[model samples]
Target: MSNPDITTPVRRPRRLRTSQVMRDFVAETHLDPAQFVLPAFIAEGIDAPREISAMPGVYQHTETSLLKAAEEAVAAGVGSIDLFGVPTPEHKDASGSQAWAADGILNKGVAALRREFGDDLIVMADTCLDEFTDHGHCGVLTTDNWGHTVVDNDATLPLYATMAVSQARAGAHVVSPSGMMDGQIRVIRDALDAEGFEDVAILAYSAKYAGAFYGPFREAVGSTLQGDRKTYQQDPRNARESIMEVQLDIEEGADMVMVKPAMPYLDVLRQVADMSTVPVAAYQVSGEYAMITAAAQNGWISREPAILDSLTGIRRAGADIILTYWATEAAQLLA
Candidate 1:
């Protein structure tokens, strides 16, 4: 006998990977349709759906198209739909007042989705003001004594609170506050409770970083941002800071927490997921979608496999829920 240990390989890990069925059987992390959340944009005055140039397959939907998209998402068994409003340029204002209006695009979208799906689907509203504000900042801006124009954190809280209440009244099951305003969770939570919407849940964007990856998103929302949102959004260099942010949100009554731009910050997502008492979500942001789509289009990579692989990587990194533009298509594939 020629060294039995080395001759035939004593431990053949390949046994489990021998076939598709075998590999599926032994897989540690499995994806489900329920784990996906779709981010959708509804433009206020669009006559029809218009495809976003940067994000190849994604579109800025009109009301009709938005409904159709939701129908398709429901058919594909997507877990949730997070709606972002794109108001006409005329609606943009200093206070982002449209964000809290009952007739606002986001609130109306939420209402329509809820009416169509009833209790069958979870409707989420993006409770942020970036798309509505003329200045394109996430919050109210004022000149500090130093002559620097900065977001007024205290002033922004009440707006967020009111926006949350508006979303709740519009039948949203969850209101996601993507603005990184301090005390936002507590303020929104109290506002909801006081309005008898105690059962409404909050999904706090606890680790949204100010990064270059948001370019495609800015296009989709028709953003009017003059400068960067560096002061409020987390810096990309800081990972430990995300943990503190998550802790604060949880302590302040966040029902769930999220890490935005999932691919670039998988480490932060993993850390947040590991320490979080509630569910953790990761957003596969617009830029990530655009890059992957562009690369696949250029024949640099296979699209379907790349999509599945990216989602799997996020899932393996401990994301309980993933927000992505590919949610419906990925869910259909997984199903």
Candidate 2:
């Protein structure tokens, strides 16, 4: 009987992972609070923070609570915050007038954060109609020749341009257009430049997908969605299309490009990161947060570690920035 000697080898991969210090030293990916972007909600009539049921520990905030959260995020070293508005049903119109109004909750929230933090924080606004529109669509709707209601892409572009200008005026350093409308970035960029807000950057949601993963977000925003966004948002089945979308956004002057629903679209994230000339971002959407939180609350997993690991995995997948509900907590944990 013969046996080969296996104790000695030409290489020892485990040597670097043998200890915590060793692992830290040899780590290829490192996460920083500055690489995280938190998305916050501002409700029109709310006087206090309202917790979202599906997303544990997340809230639809009032002006006061939104400012406090912004301050806390800064203290925790989180890089930026993205704001979404929840207007009352009475205020919503077919045009989503509140979205571009200077006094809109999201606009007011951005202004307050800018006033408080000045240049210390990066303030961002979601320049989309879904949160403000009665129909819960991302754009203006019109009847097509077939007598079917559809998003009027060209007509919506002007509204997006106006919303971007308003957000810039409200002190948002970045205006994220997540409507997935064609040529949205170009119209927005043109509008910003014309309004002398050339410094305000456009963060385009280039590869956002239509999926079940967005269910929790509807609740968080108080959405009255009647149907699916599948016609506008990218189909989950396409990968090559993501590259085309990212490229078009870049050419249209997007300062940053993003892939939405980070967990499921990680491959898309990687492709966008590789293809894009601008910084790449991945959104850990509401459903992703809800799933993890639900599992943790059920005692199936350790909450804090899972959060950190999820963010770390996204970072390792080539996302330059991660937009997550757990941004502040993760930043604090990383500290």
Candidate 3:
């Protein structure tokens, strides 16, 4: 019996690994340009697009450049874009009022993209106040008796609702609420429904974490925040909390849910993707992009392949959509 068993193997696991085509044919995951949602920034005061030092090749685009870049991204086969704004210091206020203004730079960017693409591309506006607030907090702040400033959840919900309505009015196809404020999704949904913007979808950042991974983003947005957002953003130490957050957002009427800083939280993404009824998206945030770019720039790794591999890994983790700074370049490469 031992001689017979050693003489013949019943199955050969390496059969699928015989060639690239064979491996690809049996591959469980695939990537497509339409699966990517590009994250773009538009600055209110810049004459031309200015590159962020920490995030090389990513820019603080002027409104004009924003339209151009968005068009290029779409032309490269990217399916959608998520817009962020960087207000001039003078325009920033305690309330981040510009965030909901009709003429707000982010609103303008959304309008510009809508006009240029005309329903050809999915235009998403970032419904957050961090870029417009002088304090750089995602919500309104108040000083407690101990002189500690904390975000007022109730006060911020109304602002988020108002900002969401403004983005919808500006022709945004989707409003992504990333502030992580409690009840934000329901509030925005109610506000949008009341204003007859029921057509606009909500992509909630349901599992955003308070991590050091957001360091490069501060520079990209010109943040004024002196402290952290541990109170609102989820703690990375807990996985169950992420599932709870996703459930709450879904019940609140989120059309989609996202896991932020995708690579680090892929397990969380997997969990969310498995249970969520709606589409699950993942954000490959600024810091994530910076690290990969930095390593590539140093010649320590191949940039293009690494980008493709990272994106493939995210897709394999079960994300229906991926918001990344590499959307355009990756889309072109994949094509």
Candidate 4:
């Protein structure tokens, strides 16, 4: 009795963690592969996947390789695959006309994926101009009387609408508008409906910010952006304004909304999750992935736990879906 009295007096919490089975049973949060969506980049006419040096383990897939990757994602139980296109430099232009071209690489990828998987996997297209634009700003650019570069909001809306309908026609289950242009959702929704694509959904990047976290993404997409996106994307300083952006997009007919660079803006995520009537998604953007991979490569931290922890943290902060470069790897880990 005297020997046991010491342990009883301390009321040790270690009892709950004494066994793996017990720990599993008491776990409050669980990661599922089905909640993850892999973001894949496809370039035109490449024979092999082109690895991005900065982002370890990620690549720009050829159409053939993209289909294979999609199959792998489906096999791994990933819920969806988000597609982006890296056009041949010759195809890029001031207006990013390739974005809405039915025969563009992204559209071709969509059609091929639809043929391969049909409705088995949720196929999403990134309906933005950055990847296709020569200048790499999200929208069409113009100049003021003083020749200052400006993003013409009204002028860019219809192009987004066209891109949305084109993506829908190519068999994308969702059109994700990451351009951050005003009234883009309304324009896209109207365009989709008018084109008889009533079933296609809009996944709006409602709370995207002009943050440094997008550096790796710019490189991933081969972006040529010369300046910042502060004029269009949300300011990082204001959380309350993000709610307005989300609300406006929802009112404009967004089916789902996303918060970019998930970890840093989790407070924003929580606020968006609480206020939104629809599902919430979070993007563990390129920089976030690069940082973790870099640390793991340097042996600064254990990779598996860090990956799981990062995703779990996103989920815990109220993301129903997570768009991550680590989606496939994390899904495999879960499996």
lDDT of 3 by residue, 1-335 (tens): 34576667779989989999999899888888887999999998889899999999999998788888888888898999999989999999999999999998899989998988988899999999999999999999997789989999889999999999999999999999999998999999999999999999999999999987888888988999968899999998888999999999999999999999899999999999999999999999888899999999999999999999999999999899999999999999977
Clashing pairs in 2: none
Model 4 agreement with the true structure over 1-335: per-residue lDDT tens digits: 34665445577678889998999888888888898999999988688999988898889998888888988899999999999999988999999999999999899998888889999999999999988889988888888899999999999999999999999999999999999999999999999999999999999999998988977777778888878899999899999999999999999999999999798999999999999999999999999999999999999999999999999999988999999998888999987
lDDT of each: 0.94, 0.92, 0.93, 0.92
RMSD of each: 1.1, 1.9, 1.7, 2.0
Candidate 1 local lDDT, residue 44: 87
Better structure of 2 and 3 per TM-score = 2
Candidate 2 whole-model C-alpha lDDT, 0 to 1: 0.92
- Every model's TM-score: 0.98, 0.97, 0.96, 0.96
Whole-model alpha-carbon lDDT for candidate 3: 0.93
The candidate that achieves the highest TM-score relative to the unseen native structure? 1
Candidate 4 shows a clash count of 0
The pairs that clash in candidate 3 are none
Can you give the lDDT of residue 293 in candidate 2? 90
* Segments in model 1 whose C-alpha atoms lie over 4 Å from true places: 1-5
Model 4 stretches astray by more than 4 angstroms: 1-13
